[model samples]
Target chain A: MAFPDRFDGLPAAPRCEGVYKVTGDTRGNNVAIDVLGVTKVFGAADSGFRALDKVSASIRQNEFFTLLGPSGCGKTTLLRLIAGFEFPTEGRILLDGEDIAALPPFRRPVNTVFQSYALFPHLTVAKNISFGLEMLGWPATKIASTVERMLALVKMEPMADRLTDQISGGQQQRVALARALAPNPRVLLLDEPLSALDFKLRKEMQIELKRLQGETGITFVFVTHDQEEALTMSDRIAVMSAGRILQVGSPREIYDRPTERFVADFIGETNFLEGEAKVAGDRLLEVRLDAGATVKATAPDAALHAGRTTVAVRPEHADLVPGDGPADLTGVLKNIVYFGTDTHFHMTLDNGVPFIVRQQNTPGEGSGFSIGEQVGVRLHADAAQALKD
Target chain B: MQPHEVEQAAIRRGTMRRWLLSAPALVIIFLASFGPLFVMLAFSVLEKGDYGGVKPWTFSFDGWANVFFQHDIFTGELGFADAHLSIFWRSVRLSIITTALTLVLGFPTAYFIATRPRKTREIWVFLVTIPFWTNLLIRTFAMQEVIRNEGVINTVAMRLGMISEPIQIMYTDWAVLFGMTYVYLPLMVLPLYASMEKLDFRLVEAAYDLYANRFKVLRRIILPLTKPGIIAGSILVFIPSLGAYVTPRVLGGGKNMMLGNLIGLQFGKGNNWPLGAAISITLMVVVMVALLVYVRATARAGGDDRGR
Candidate 1:
């Protein structure tokens, strides 16, 4: 694949793909967190296990970047490394071109809203918010103004005097945010900040967080396992697995054009058609299925290898036509799930491979197909990405 | 048929079973703990019999009055300037000294052990408590051997030519304090360790992250947070040391007699049961008051995180 001409003027990508890019230019306010080849190992060398394996990604200033991954994927470790709570085994963390890896958490120009909120039980909300200002030796008047401003930002001014233990979990989250932002860090690290909240509160906080990021104009490196959160709030997302970043791009790029099978499966539901790749054209690849059908998919990132591959087609992208067409694959509609927003049809092909087809709930009618009915599943060639095994 | 009835029946059965199982143990504990104390209280107010046994018909304040008001004949052996106040003052001072020394030595040690990694913490706690497994008298005698004129320290100092002659470490107030501290150090540490173990290291980290220096972290975060443990440890060390008999007897010899020694002499050599009982009751009351005050103070200070 040829490099995009637009990226020619941009700084060269780091040699190792997925390693953080830390440029030393002081002119650009766009780059806030530049992590270079960050790695974290738990325990001593004799018994140590690497938690983050040379994983890195730069977060731009004022952008809400999410590190999305399942548990133990080292996303939280990366966030902590950036927050200066945990030093990387080997890496340089530059905050605004200053090497902050050697600096203590207090000295680093970054603040973290821990997942648990970590609000001091003894302190009032006002005190918790003003702690960072006090640390900087700000005068009482300045500290008070900053604290009041932060409390107002989070809409917690009325409850500023309340003890942290007395408030609801959602309110505590806002207090934590207020506290972190009151410090006016160049970058904000949120470690699964919404995981503790209930579903409704999480959604509300997501919107609130996005707005707060915009209002503060500070980079936010949010860590979460929920792909929906990343899709909803992030300007860019880095999908990690097994302590290494698998893919990094905008949410659309990750969801629509995932680079790896793991990223495809992790980000959203997909029916993986196992097959052998055969080049059809410069940009297209014909994957011969194990079950005797051929699938044409757009090659993602790299040229498809000949031996073995899989075509990732999202369930929603595969449409059920009235009857079999020239390019359509025939299947029996085995089941239908009537979700409020969409209707899902589980279909079985002649070779018995189960394929799921999701259709959005349009105004006039729902899915025309029923259980145990014959249907034809059609997918756009552009919707499927050919991935290596 | 109803849920409430079923729950009520279960609760009744649970209560019945609990009472049935604990009846014997409860009775034994009641008899063992309160019986002696009640007997001592009764003796303090009872009229002394011509014989050794108490006269049940007559009760008087004469025994307490004699001990409190005038120097009884037994004072000669006890060697207190005043019969009651002098011995009481000595015991309070010694107990205070023992408690202070125990806190000084035990708090940091307990903090160290508690802050260790989980597996190492268990091992270190076990090491701290190992000395407690032996008989208290045996441990006191062991200390006696170490502090004696020709003991290990003197021998080492002599061999090193640091001193010309053996130092008089044993049979003094210092020896008594040392023995008391050594024996009660574990008692002091256990409660402290329990309190310190619950201390969230994040609190200290949070303090440090707020630019509070090491000393400020210690004073503002660590010390106040571990106040419950300190109070509990002090009570554990102080109450026991006030009435401790074994350490003083073994280490103090005849030179420095604490209240425990005087009480023992009154009961044993002096054969003054009334005086001994009065003194014992006094010590018990003092300890009880001290413990009560500590509990109330801790409760007021919000140190009772245990919710008891």
Candidate 2:
């Protein structure tokens, strides 16, 4: 696990046996959490639910790391393991290079902002914020000052005397965050903390969370099903599916070049076209579609190229052309959808497959095509990505 | 004919229908409660008969006066009624001890039943209530057999060579306490289990996550949250133990008489029906006062009860 010095501070690249490869710097590395082949199974051994199947991940210090997936995808299970709520069934979790697997949740220097906020109903907001500090046996003066500081940090100074159940959902969310941060844990785990808020409030809290992370500089491992929230907040994202980590990369890397099938379909809207691919050049792929069109696509991993595979393309990667010249595929325009900032032109190809082309709206200019009209979509040179499925 | 008048007439008809539907229950409650209360009050102010019954239409204050003081046979002076006072004191003291003991024993039992898996919880609660299927007198006599001389405990101890003589436990206050606590235990556990069942266990996990150990979680979270159940169970056990006649009479063996047995003594052999009725009224007053103080302290402990 030699982390290269160049990638040390910027991205904190994860280097594992099957995930990444790095060189040069081997010492003086700061790894906040290294989950080594963690497996979690609920109930009996013979007949049990395998929530996580030997999932491995490396979260670095002060990184805004996200585990993004749909529901029941082991993201929350992984977060709970890190927060010491659930112990690994067969592996070790190293926090700051120390094995914290044997420590209970109270002994571990970690805190969680649960999705339900789980605040003490009998205590006021200030007492709730200072609960962790009180449990740690800090002096009354120190606890009082810290409670005041947390109240001001969450912008809930006036709500100090109000009970937790008496506050609004958004206010309770702020108090939960402040309470978890009061203890100043080495790592903070958040399990879908923003999923309960409305769209507008969720957006505001997303930015607020990023700001807080930047200010505190604690390693934050956030779990969410919302891909847009993950992309908007994370420094690096790990896309998971079905008790395993599907892919781990930057959001742009995950979106533009998903290495696997489920990752391609899960991250965002992807168009899949079956084709026979051949190695064109160095890191270049020549894919011949089933519809008699030969297009040059970029290989995500050149070493893993195969002959018969599917090429995934995003809707925004292609533009609709009137004639067939300089077009990758020609089809009939089936439908047109207009959004506020973009429009989607639904085209049925000559092979009878549904293909969508998205184009930005330039103020009063339409897509310049009507329904049932013949159209062709031209792909950018880097749009089509070769999947190794 | 008008819409407003028709609507008002319909509203009036609905109110009449509601009252009609509840009339039977209200009438039964009044007849069952106030009817006996009036008879008891009337008998308490009447003159005592020669044998057992009270004389009609002849009012006397001797029954009420005898409650606190007794006239001396030689000096014609009123003195403190030490016998009646001691009996009342013993009843109150035993009831409080019984309530405290049941709470200490029943809390852990209720918590255990509440924390069991949902399917098994019903079985545990059903077991707790199984004692109610039999008669209270039978249960008290069964308990007497366990604590009496030459009974189960003494016989087992002697057989095991652990004692040379039988322990004199049956005709003591300990016997009465044990019997009352045994009979009234289910009353405490049931309400406590009901409250513990509704507890949000995530809060307990949250406390543990925040560095609070097991004792702190019980004291700060579980105890306060289930105060309503604790108060309800205490009152349930305390009221019954206060007026409990069968257990104390069967186990106390006429020497350790409680308020219930003392009041019964007036009616059965004392030949003073007025004094018995007066003592019965006094016992009811003590129960009411105990309930008031318990409720007031519990209400203060839980401000406004909205959280529960």
Candidate 3:
């Protein structure tokens, strides 16, 4: 496209003079945003609601990072702090190598797509996109050209002259993203930006957001309560709860090797079995379940201290053995539920502890277990991991 | 009847019921507003009476002409009465000035109230409307007590060793302007507050995050969005101030007179009821012209907003 040539060899995003400086990154400033022990307390210093408690994380450049948590878990508060909308009560936020904790929102090279997609009702879609460049005193020609490029970027060229309120909710979301990205902020904060859409559209936009992040090369800090969204779109996910980050890792690592019980329970569906762990060997632990079953499990790297252990087994990892077979644990079949692609066997262990085993509905298997019958269940090796309580 | 014809008859019935429901309001507006206005127009075209009433059925152009011209007693020739023009000018100038001043004071107050926490916002709005609970005359008089010489301000300042003599603030344009602005302030604030209250402040935050400072945010995002409130509040403050009689009379001390006070003089001491009615209609015409200007301004703004 002719668009790339117009920016005059600069790059995907613009570098407005005072908003961001192009000083080469040194002193381990490869991280786009380095948050150091930031604390945010609202209302009163002595007895305020602590939204974020000494949270520290590093968001790498050009990575789609997500803060995943339930409601009121301080994910949005951390995003606001990085955007400079709210100041941290302690510590500092560094964008590149410089401290930006004292700067107001306008002085930082950051933008946000608010949860409501707060578009300007008074301006046309085109003018809304041009507002940032205009505020930076870009010449009229440059603003017009850049606005055109942004219109084409979001595929909203036909709706350029329409007022923001004249469009659908999804269209407004796109316009908001285009407007925020027009000025070429180094980082873009999304506060549950896709939470308002329907399920189908939310899925579509999730893919679109990832594509946009890849194309723009701007670090994306997405906040969401949907674990599936974080797992599907994020390069790294930070699990937060009660004003503190519980864990941070890739989606596979978070799903496979969750260190905390909360992380394991929050990221995906799992059957948590309470157990006591004794060191069986290096990288292994023998967990004696409260249900009077002893199962061998892998020891997570971080949760190896002397403490109680909880084994999290994904529902799909176990299979139902009908009357008797070579199985490690035994239970009585209570009920069975059928999903489209899979069937779940709900049963109770010998001591009344709930157990669920999910199996794909393979063709012509002809295996059935009646309720009120004792059954044997076998867990696949390496399916269990010890989590810290 | 045919099936489609029956449906059409039902639609007609619904429309007729709506018009019937609205008829009482239309009748009240016509009788209360236009009825007196037609009488004034008729009286403005008639001749002045000798005994302080209109000479009914007497056709004359003198009543309308006397609004701009009067007979010179010595020359017996008609000429411009500059006093009427000055009174008209004072009324227009002060109304415009009062609207500007109220807007200057009310915008920040409304924004502050709007940006406050939702629970405390109600309390601040309640405080703003506290002045409306009292009578306008009482409030004007209360203001008179504060700014007048030998009043609260002069007494307090003198006792505090701030000045030796009282400042003459009572009988000037400043007193009238001050009184009018103070009385009309709530009108501006309420509409501005209502609009500011509905404003999505996340749009404001978005503006700031997109590289707009406080000034740019106000200019680009805040002001244009709240323009309807500005227009409504300006009209509310400006119209009442143009015809103000009580505030000017109580605080302006007889020398400074607005159009309403001048119209009162023509009916009482001047004994020219025709001229009084003539000037009243002229005042209405001025109001219409001012409203036309406001409508033109808003239409232009609305057109620009459409991005044609």
Which prediction has the highest DockQ against the true structure?
3
Better of 2 and 3 by lDDT: 3
TM-score of each model, in listed order: 0.82, 0.91, 0.94
Model 1, A265-374: lDDT tens digits are: 99889987877887888767888776566778777646455657888889988788865554356778888998999988888876788888888898886566678877
User: For candidate 1, what is the lDDT?
Assistant: 0.79
Encode model 3's per-residue lDDT on A1-389: one tens digit a residue: 22232133444443222212222342354578888999999989879999999999887777788999999999999999999989999988988757999899998878899999888888899988988887877789988888898888788999999999899888898999999888777889999999999998899899888878777777789999999999999988899999999988888888987878899889877888888788888868888887766888877766564447889888888888975777767889898888869888898988778889998897875457788999988888888888866
Q: Give candidate 1 misplaced runs (Cα > 4 Å).
A: A1-29, A44-47, A122-151, A156-165, A274-300, A303-309, A326-332, A348-354, A364-366, A371-374, B1-34, B46-62, B66-86, B115-121, B199-218, B303-308
Worst 10 residues of 3 chain A by lDDT: A14-23
The reply for model 3, stretches above 4 Å from the true place, is: A1-29, A290-293, A364-367, B159-162, B305-307
Q: What TM-score does candidate 3 reach?
A: 0.94
Instruction: Give the Cα error of residue A278 in candidate 2, in Å.
Output: 3.0
In model 3, residue pairs whose N, Cα or C atoms come closer than 3 Å (at least 3 residues apart or on different chains), thus clashing, are none
Expressed as tens digits, the lDDT of each residue in A220-321 for candidate 2 is: 899999989988888788999989998887788888988877888887788888888888887678889986677777776732475897888899998899
lDDT, each prediction: 0.79, 0.85, 0.87
Count clashes in each candidate, considering only residues at least 3 apart in sequence or on different chains: 0, 0, 0
Worst lDDT run of 10 residues, candidate 3 chain B, spans B299-308
Model 2, range B1-308, lDDT digits (tens) per residue?
89999999999999999999999999999999999989998999999998889989999979988988898889988999888999999999999999999999999999999999999999999999999999989988899889989799999999999999999999899999999989999999999999999999988888888888889889878998888899999999998888889999999988999988988888999988889889999989999998998888877766642222
Per-residue lDDT tens digits for candidate 1, residues B1-308, read 69999999999999999999999999999999999988898887877666444578578886676566764475544333464676677778999999999998998999899889899999998999898689988888888889899999899999999998999989888898889989899999999999999988876666655555666667766887788789988988898888888887888877577778888887776666777788788778888898898788867766332211
Tell me how candidate 2 scores on lDDT. 0.85
